[model samples]
Target chain A: MQTSTHANPRALRDIEMALERTKAEIPVLTPMVTAFGPLLAERFRLREAASGWVGPLPVVDAERFSQGVFVLADSGFQDMSAHLSEAAHGLLPIMANSFPAMAQELNTLIAAMDNGALTMDALAAAGFGEAFTVPGVNAETMDFAVAELVRPFVERQAQDLAKLVRDLPWRQTICPICGGTPNMSVLRRIRNDSEFIQAHGGRRFLRCSCCATEWTHKRISCPSCGCEEPDELVVLSDPSRPFERADACHRCKTFLLCLDTGELADIPDPDVAALTMLPLAHQARRQGFVPLAEHPWGGL
Target chain B: MPKAIFIDTTRCTACRGCQVACKEWKNFPAVPTKQRGTHQNPPDLTHYNFKLVRFSEHLEGDVVQWYFFPDQCRHCLEPPCKEASTVDGAIIRDDATGAVIYTEKSSKEDLETVRSACPYNIPRQDPVTKRLVKCDMCIDRVRANLLPMCVKSCAMGAMNFGNREDMLKLAGERLEAVKKEFPKASLLNQDDVSVIYLVADLPAKYHEFAVAGVSGSMTRKQMLARIFAPVRKIGQQVRG
Candidate 1:
């Protein structure tokens, strides 16, 4: 069933308000996306595919085919709020229940923002991700950009992503619903607001693009070829986002980005947090392996 | 089991998630595009873009209805494009995924014949490689046990993929559900291809050749050649 709960007028209003706020926040977050350009570039393959967009590039013999796919994946949009909301929903209620006063305080902060006292900058200062600042971006854009940015990073976290993919529970020929691929491979680890035990809390597994099903993909396997050769497959990482890496298999010659939340102090929006690793993607592409997709914020 | 993708136009929000996902999964590139007074970016499919969501608006009674057809090579059971190719591995259907794959061999094939033989006007020639290209249904990914990229990326659930039996079932269910709302709703070319469409109106109302017959049949010689074409391949191999 289509989830009408979020499509109703009130929800639409909330989403619209959220989008407008998110767009406004773009000017503010531009600095962050710009700051981590190399990591993002490396992971996302930020380069021109062709002189023209609609037609073939000057290169031939399917070489451009690889580059083209790389470019699209890099720039693909991801729905940010949905995942953020999903993550936040789990974390929020606990705060509301355990520390009712802090929860009340958080509500007041949001209320102040609703009343225009808390600027997007202020929200960022308070550790809220940029997604809460913008408005108008539907779930699709967030989903695309987020997936584009994070998928490779997540894939890279596991040594042999292909093997990891082979073990995933939702491993099917097509997505159960939309027939898309795995956007973010998650390990079902949920963290409550209490101690904020940043690591090893949320679900653990790979997330599918079609149905967003998060299933267990082994930690050290190629997500594409399922090849078990660690020597044939290598993992590349960025110093900035030490938790993330680009896993490339020499055997299949395909690469997936990976993020190790076990290393982060906060729940990284696989999409937004991945901006720190784009340049690594570019470096990987220069080495000849193609990323699954382009990171969405590459050009922006 | 052979897999198929069921596209329900009625459910499409024209978000182009499938379009982007198809490119992403296939590892195809971004086609440079402009605002052509329509959201249909990059206009039509090309060598790099295997799947394209075509949008057309028409007046139905007093309402202006916008129709979207996420277009791609149909991967016909007997793909005319495959029959048109004289080169080996140029356009071979993977028996596993039933995916009509256009390999590098296409660069050597007679491009005009292959392009013209396509009933859906699909297939574009790459200027540089001189190879023909279209959707391969992400066979590599399918082989890796994942959904087709386009199917995976669709956010609106307009696109679906599964075994032929399941896709047909879903297509039938969608058709029946859609028919109650739109009496003319039906599935297009469900029998001949892996990509089946659940359209909410007369197929033609969506596109001139939205229906299977619109592309017309293969020429008499092409038809005959297609039948004998397989034998020709074996003969050439045996002779060599």
Candidate 2:
């Protein structure tokens, strides 16, 4: 569940591997998971390729970064055509499988991008957070799909520059790389230098909602409002599945679903891991705790 | 502080849910049994049954008073069984939770000596592996921030698990309330053991091994200290 922000080609394999493992581990999710497998694998392929080719994004300003400013929040990933075209090509067919009713609309969107009549940057400016002229696609689905498409470029930039700001404690609830809020929290296993285990992991790392960047966060603090009271933070989990959990903050009435990678047999890709905790997310919402951010498969 | 369990016997309905839950948690198979003409099944702790609810009946004038005691490892504050272990890592006391855990290496130790050292007579050795097996306070569940199986399964609110401080505070609050009805009510050896039981009546009325035996009135730590004094002195002298 602790998918590091390394956009190496192995991720292409890991995403599919995680999907297969998830199918084997929780057969109940196989049908829903099988449908999205190609889309996710293709996304990871773009991300790996972007890691090698896509670059020259703005470098982080250390002064602004220390003051809780995000690297690419203001100056967004420019000239989105290079990254967006291939992402759309790989995604449209897979999108067809999931959205058969919207096949006509999907084709329209596909043609617009292919012929350069419609650009992703133009779509971001005009359509995002507002009603889209592109017919038939729901706002939430559009947002989710756009986020998925743009993720590879953002992630590659974050991966390339992670070492520069690794040690500097931001203490902010959002991702330093893309100024994105966390979709989920992960308790990463901390390995010691020697043979003997110095400590067992409780280290909390928040995985970005947009770019897949992981940043250290206060374990007791609420991601929504930054409440630090231990009493306010309530842990909800199924005893049978100790790996999955939701940390509910009573103060803000918000919860973030979490995966303890230490308990899992394999380190699942972040997107795949969040899908596995669909039940926990439902449980959290049922308890009247709002999720900080939804995964790309928001409606599902 | 280490973890602790507070058992309020006053609230226990003798449902034996805890007993069944312990067996389920350990994944221990059922043993052959015949009706012994009592509600309590598997009457005592065995290799399979680490927890057993004892049903004791007493006649007070014309009234028949029944007391149910859920017996398991006390996980003593300073476990003498740990000192009695001859093999290293056999009887490990987890520093984090103070859980008296018997590992696979426990097979190397003399079962008699280690078992005898425990005031509660809780340790039961496996015939095949020879390792002492008992309630580990479900350390696996505790570490995962889940309630122990016995505590989780209890519907009567008789069992409570938490930090040692919290459990002690709860035991005191429960003891005060129970004392209003049953005057002889007390939290038994709360300081000496992590598993604090609030009994409604005299400790012996519940079980003989309730608060350690009458002959062995001293706490297990004190007894171990007395027995191992000579060995400690010799070791100190040898070091010097």
Candidate 3:
């Protein structure tokens, strides 16, 4: 059995600490924290393991590139599917023992995904269409849960493709590996040899919500509409909290939440930071603007 | 990055979408109004309306050209109101977004002093709440990854927002394009305020305070006060 070490142990610890802090700060989120926290930690472990299994992926043609262009073309998909199925099986207790055959179904889904046979239409045809539906849960909520469960396996394939085409000239707003809209934007400070200290300058990276692929994008443009007109974009930030802000575009009526990691004492998991900004999401919705991607926390 | 909004006055159709959207988003109660002989209803920015689309008319050769100016707080880079306010938290500038915010504590401050300090005559006081109010740049929405309601509701592409550098660049580009047709096209107070207005005509053809330097003459004492305001606040903090 290959031991899973997808995320670095220290990073995993940090994520746990962030979850704990988030739980402490928002008591209402305790139930959710208790439910998904362990799963996320496990996912991190899977991601760490996946990081080590990097292999050559087929080059994506720049001309006809789309987010779904890269499909799993290696035998590693089998190992990834097996590992993820085991992970999904571990969740049976928390899932109230529902979806008893989830592991077998997940394996089937993984194989189908690897072979480009796992589209929504295909899933519907295979009678797994309602697999995500739970009695009281909204479709979006259920979809989020399902995505979380399968993310580790999907991330493995995405990581390999991301590495293979890291230097490709990808200009699309969607992720080159998964074709998914970015869930979070992170700003990291740039350090040069002349400046021993970190410079105020930074680059913006868009992280895919589905497969965890990250790509660099223009700092001032809207990721949704590709609005390079600076006049059509706005940065909204809470006066009380200066570290996080929403980059909203007037043209597309879309916004993307961004976190400045350089301002923090310790780097936080982008996912955790995004979750904590649920109040901001509410504020955005009230103003009639939507996010670039349909985020799990967006329903809140 | 510090953020800004660019208003292209040439594109404003005076639909009042921005004005209505600002009120709707802020949830400010409507103030009674009568038609003021022109399409510019309510006439001026009131306590209920943080944003007002001002209308003015001028004769260009033979045709009567109507100008629309959506008036709101400029959210000055170095806000004079912030400098003039003695009350703690009465006025604050968000370092992250460059939004000049008037807090609830502003109710306790001398409203006239804060009002007089503005170069653009933007601030208004709510008679009931006593809180000084202005366009907050929709800081709440902006922080939440949403465009300001005014910007969102504007279908004409007149109002826009983004980082200060990008907005400035856009203003320059738009000004160049607009000047090709309207020789007098210019950007209003681009260097000193978060809201940059790209007007297609002379500044006077718009509202009186459409450009800075048209209002609120600064005394030497006020200038000194503006310069030393930060030091004085810090000194007060130390003393306290």
Candidate 4:
């Protein structure tokens, strides 16, 4: 059984505000925002398609679980692939004029996905790797495009799976919902009710870049290397934006940007917050540490 | 496989690039000091300074010989300082980089006990933060697939960092070549620690604690404390 909570209107408002703010803030990202705006608008449609679909929950073996498996097989995405492919096609304008061949390839790929002939292996076999290498279209940009398309459906699936596994022990750094590494972390004051008093305490949760799943993680441990030593960990922040900081692991030389939602007057979408924190990623790189996951803006 | 750093002292020219680079990378402010009459400034390692290149001179066979020892944490394979830490997360060895890190929680630990347990006398306490500090092997740079600041800044190729096996191989090759001139050339505590030093003369000539077995200064109580530390930690966790 799944408990349904009403969607917060403020979160949608935050995403809209962020989309507008990002365009004005970073001039270099204008083209990306222009390309992604329409695709993001299609998320509700994809979510509708995902909600109407029915499938059994994935069964993962212990070995696969340890290896960070969330989606068990290619069949899991069969029901929602058409909607995802339609989303992928919506980004065709960004690709068509610059690289006709790549756009043509994407068209074929989308058609194949719609036809149930585009499993991951089939997509690989259909020269997706070669298509992504086209001029002005690299792996990172291609990843962003695909993620924008599939995220809505993947997120819905993840939510349903998350409901079933709420009580299971998952200690790994990877997201238990979608098996994706975290691109950002959230530091929020979680409400607690004990005795007769209500209180709040700071808790850290990692948000996945792929499916938007959030999982509780230890506050002190490095998500990358699992180094619990407090001295080896350092939190760096831009002097101007103290609310956004990078939790760096000196031991592993890796960092993950964290957003203190508690500090925000208006909470921003976590995905949009990731875009705003590109400067933090560059700062972490300047200090000789890699981001746990690559940001869409490529700073990570 | 664990990572390690190999320092060939024979190739070092006492340029102090490694020392300066460490301070630069860590953003450590310079310590104020009077002239100590030697090239080594600040006299000894402090909380701010994690790496220090020590200079020593001795007369051997009526000839003046100078030994330059770039002193830092050895990052022992089984760190005694970690064993001595009573406070949780005061000290921990990084599983990926093999760095023995002194965390901010060290402020809650007995500094003397943690300091005395180190066979190499590496940890230093900050007067302001009340936290113990030392070399963390430049793990940040290492994890980014770059050499440690000290190794990167070394122009003489005396400092090298890589996998344990590759460093041991380099140490062995350097030792073989150095042995042609100095028969006593050897790698110091290579098996016991991550930082392997290739010294052309006796290990003591480089630094007092360059080799592990040579030091018997650790008190019997410290030894016993280290031996039973793991058991005590488990018992405490269970009790809690």
Top-lDDT candidate index:
2
What's the TM-score of chain B for every model shown?
A: 0.88, 0.90, 0.90, 0.91
Per-residue accuracy of model 4 over A139-258 as CA lDDT, tens digit each: 555554565555676677766666655555566788776567898888764422122221222467788766677877777899998998989999989765666889999999999989
Q: Is the docking of candidate 1 incorrect, acceptable, medium or high quality?
A: incorrect
Question: Positional deviation of A179 in candidate 3, in angstroms?
Answer: 9.9
True contacts kept of each: 0.00, 0.00, 0.00, 0.00
Error in Å for residue A204 of model 2 = 0.9
Candidate order by lDDT, highest to lowest? 2, 3, 4, 1
DockQ computed for model 4 against the true two-chain complex using alpha carbons: 0.01
Candidate 1 residues lying further than 4 Å off, grouped into runs, are: A1-300, B214-240
Task: Assess each model's interface with DockQ, reporting 2 decimals per model.
Answer: 0.01, 0.02, 0.01, 0.01
Off by over 4 Å in 3: A1-300, B214-240
TM-score of each: 0.44, 0.54, 0.49, 0.45
Q: Residue A39, candidate 4: how far off, in angstroms? A: 29
lDDT of 2: 0.76
**Candidate 3 residues B1-240, lDDT tens each?**
588999988778898999998999888888899977898888889999999999988887999989999999999988888988777888999997899999998887667767777778888998989999999999987765456778767666777776688789888988998898999888987888899999888898788878767334554434755776677566656765
Question: Could you give candidate 1's per-residue lDDT for residues B13-114 as a string of tens digits?
Answer: 788877887776667767777888998887888887888888898997899989999998888888888886667777888887788998887777666667
